[model samples]
Target: MKIFGYQLGGEKRSGSIENPTVPVSAENFMQFFGVQSGNLPSVTIDSALRVPAIAAAVSFLSGSLANLPLHAFKPKGDGSERIKGGIQKLLNEAPNPEWTSFGWRKYFWQQVFTGGRGVSWIERNGATTAAIWPMDPSTTVVKRVNGRRIYVFDGKSEYPASDVIDVPFLLKKDQISVYSPIMLGSKAISLALAMGDYAGGFFAGGGVPPLALSGPLPAGADAIKRAQSDIRRSIDSAKSNDEAIFPIPPGYKLEAVGFDPQKGQMTEARRFQIEEAGRIYSLPPVFLQDYTHGVKANVEQQDLHLVKHVISQWAKALEEELNLKVFGPRSNGRYAEHNLDALMRGDFKTRMDALSRAVNSALRTPNEARNLENLPAMPNGDTLYIQGATVPLGSQPLLQAPPTGKENDKGNENGDGNDSEA
Candidate 1:
């Protein structure tokens, strides 16, 4: 029999069409329960430890048991001794003693795949205590003094002491949502962004929802109008130029050109040209506002891929710009593999500092060196704005300058008195 896609060896499946029920016999019950009725239930499991078959049977008998007289049944001889033995067996099966003493290892850990006290943190006076993961050595869980459901984790070590870090959100319900960059106070939202669930992430990250165009007026109506106007102007210009060069060939009516009224104003000339062009000749209509909007929407929807590509490009540019050797697990389309093995085996603190330095080096700002004195300056009176000396149009400025008496003497000394070459 298949239960939740698992086959049970040698079990008969007999049940109703609407609500299927598994058949159970005294022998099958004993085998399934791991106890014998002959010993009067000597070794029953703990009340906290519930099995499917036992739970279902108890549920089925609850209503029926109420109808039967409670005082009608009598306890068998030494029944109290059997009960004591069962209780002892249950106490023996209660989880490891260290789990109870250390508080981090919770009882319901098997129900979840990710976290427990390993997932806990500490807070003080309604504030997060410190960063409490692999890096942190002393973070603990904080519980409200009198409340049953309130808890807080203070992340002072991971962040500045001033910020209040919300910890309940740090642990995500889904594994895919866990790798995102953590926000200063909003770890949940950051994780959502890293997982590429932008809309969900935005909501989780305390971002406002996008307004839909449900009524006659859209939220970005003004921007859309401006964009559409710009698009129309370009198309109109193209149409006018095309019309001037090639006026509609004689006797061809506009209706015969297959224009749709619902699609708004479109130039017949542009449509004809587009139709004439085959698939390969067709372009992306870069100037069209509607096309641009569609492209932007698609890119925004798949922004993670774009971000990854941009990061890769930046990393490559950084490698070329800075003469530093870089190392990454997934750089240059090759896996780091054992390249990081030594770092993993060595002091993690030193490795972390090295990684930070390398990343910062790659992102260093370019220097702007200049000779300030060589730059042009404004006139003394008009010191507010820098002005370049104006050169007169008619002649070279140096030649046009009013001549001093010394200049004429210098010219005469250079044989400025003209004489034709003999």
Candidate 2:
């Protein structure tokens, strides 16, 4: 079962010891796994990026958040924001000298997905955040002293917790930093990719049929070996040709060795691997292109589920980290929020219906609705309008009429007079 030098179902061996005097090349390590040396053995960020499912999941999450409007808000009595300006420019335009707002968010989310922790170095000027820069999570280390966490960058420069903004995926007991998903799920991901390689190799060899020899035995061991070699050469030549046909010797017959890919469930196995990788990142099967259990009717619900369960959690983590590091602990009322309206938007008719309800109920102004739709506002768009016929609760109806018989008396008199004249 061994593909590379590494045994498939056997005791594992460490690739290299920590603090080794001699440097080991990546190619040498990769060769230990029966796979080609060109493919690296270790599941580092670079290696994981090669896996399409992992790349897609990371891109979807980071890109989605990066594109969203991240606003800075001051808390109000009604649990709303007063839309402040202090951190607004920093978040919306550029968070640092090097990266735009979108670039910053994308980099942060990429780190979070790959390492389970996103670290950023904050540059502040007298209680105001001037700029920010993302730090390499792989090289950064967290150390605690005097019961306070300290971040050591590249084993050289040291920074206080307040100076660095850290968003962690999942924290372990007594640990200030988060665990890396890539490091934890490396084996599973590597195995899945290895299986993919194996499948590709199987097909690339032209589905060569197995050869069976029967009839009188050759007189000597050399003769039998020669016969077997000839048969293998013939099969190889046939497989290499476009037309997979070959002449068989008098005593040899050939049979197809394996089941069809469908019957053997090879496709299913590959699909399961994709789903499994998606699970490692808490992504939906649909995100990885697995639509076996999906229906068009439920697609929107599935998207909502992804936003609520996956993207929201990451968004909240980033928001809280930014609030704490960028705004400071004393700034209790200020926070960062990602506008998820775009992601949650439904079909045109559904969105219009919802907007209409909001406007009618005074929850939103006409101008606000127009702004959401990116349309020009009218002169009176600021006014909040309710249905004219809508009445207050527990109040008498304004349109109610007097008893029907009494109201019709005047009209009936005119009709009776006209009938007498006729």
Off by over 4 Å in 2: 1-42, 75-86, 209-241, 248-263, 375-377, 397-422
**What TM-score number comes out for model 1?**
0.15
lDDT for each of the candidates?
0.29, 0.76
For model 1, how does the per-residue alpha-carbon lDDT over 1-422 read when each residue is reduced to its tens digit? 57733346654543312112333565555544333442321112232113222222222222221121111111356431112322122112221223221122122211111121123222223331222221121243343333332323344433221222122213455321222111221222222222234334445633423321122222244544454455446546666675433222223212222223224333333333222221111112221112323477664443343224422342233222111111122223311111121312246676556544443454211110011112343334221221235545865644476756786667767998543453
**Which predicted model would earn the best TM-score?**
2
TM-score of each: 0.15, 0.76
lDDT of 2 at 248: 61
lDDT of 2 by residue, 57-81 (tens): 7888788878888888887896766
